[model samples]
Target: MNTIPEIATRLASLCNEFKFVEAYIELYADNAVSIDPNNKNEPITGLHNLIEYEKRFLSNVEIHDIKVSEAIFAGSYFSLVFSMNFTVIGQGSKMVEEICVYKVENGKIVSQQFFIG
Candidate 1:
């Protein structure tokens, strides 16, 4: 059986693969929040809201060769580094790295912050 931490990793991987708002929202709590640098107009909220957000940004983005640099698990929170090559809608593909801090409660993510470079 997979541990909770492992499950969390799988969830993260799935999110990276789809990059759809609904995919992430489903992994979070009903009232979850996500901090995104690219989307400065608003902070993502709720599963439905996240789906809409994904539709805007991830509609044509493609992720490849995801490398999990690290995964730190706390009692109810986790931090992760995901390095990947990605292509935007009209831009060429490039190598990018992102670190994210996530707060999970009752098996659902409650808050998340993304750091991309």
Candidate 2:
């Protein structure tokens, strides 16, 4: 986890396996920040807050499939494309593709930003 590639690979692996909370707990810093489009582009600070936010979103959607692309690294940052097929509770199923960028510091993920496509 000392390198961007290592952290990115582990993050992608956990996400691909649908172990999102686990990945966050294992790889993110305590004060990690997450910027999500769905949240009106406001940054969610702290790992605990991010996990709670994730749980709320997960509870509303039923995941059918997920695909994570290989990570592309630049310095301490890395990016990956994630495609997901899911149905929102009470809504119809749909596909979403997003480019996820992450910043790592001292072997822990410090920030993550998502660009939905």
Candidate 3:
């Protein structure tokens, strides 16, 4: 993607298709930081860390459905809302509404944060 808006649009599309690993590997900078709701001790920094984090999160979960809301873009930042249903291995299926915010710099995602309420 040539611009941040394009990247955001594609990122949301990848997420809707459940391409979590590909999304982070392709769109995130080498030193990007990702803050997930699962662990908040410190932000997961670097592309490798983000990829591993996503991999671990997706490893045993059964993805039931994903609905991606239209993204809201402001400057080089954007937010996407996801309604997801999944079964977390030992845990039963659950539905969650999460908002993911991304900050794009140099055409790569420099930082991302997730919020679920």
Candidate 4:
């Protein structure tokens, strides 16, 4: 993708299509850092850890539907909002929403942070 909005669109498409792992592999830099909702929680550092974290998250998810909306791009930053309708292990139908932002450089995401709801 040539523009930040394009990149954000691509990422949103990937996640909505249940290709979350592929999105991470293609969009993130080698040393990308990912933070969970709370600052108190240690951020997942490095590409490998990021991939593993995504895999773990997806493995437990049984996607009924997913919607990605509100992608915003400004300079070297982008934000995407998502709502996932799914089921997790030991849980029934549930809806989870997360607001994610990325610090992007040279077309690859350098750092990402998530706020869960």
Q: lDDT for each of the candidates?
A: 0.72, 0.95, 0.88, 0.85
- Write candidate 1's Cα lDDT for 50-107 as tens digits: 6676677756777767766547888777887878777886888989788888887777
Best of the candidates, lDDT: 2
Models ranked on lDDT? 2, 3, 4, 1
Candidate 2 worst ten-residue window by lDDT: 1-10
Clashes of 2: 0
Question: lDDT of candidate 3 vs native?
Answer: 0.88
- Model 3: what TM-score? 0.95
TM-score of model 4 (CA atoms): 0.90
Candidate 3 displacement at residue 63 in angstroms: 0.5
Winner on lDDT (1 vs 3): 3
Q: Could you tell which candidate, 1 or 4, scores higher by TM-score?
A: 4
lDDT of 3 by residue, 54-89 (tens): 888899799999998888988889999999999999
Alpha-carbon TM-score of each model against the true structure? 0.78, 0.98, 0.95, 0.90
Candidate 2 residue lDDT tens string, 42-105: 9999999999999999999999999999998888899999999999999999999999999999
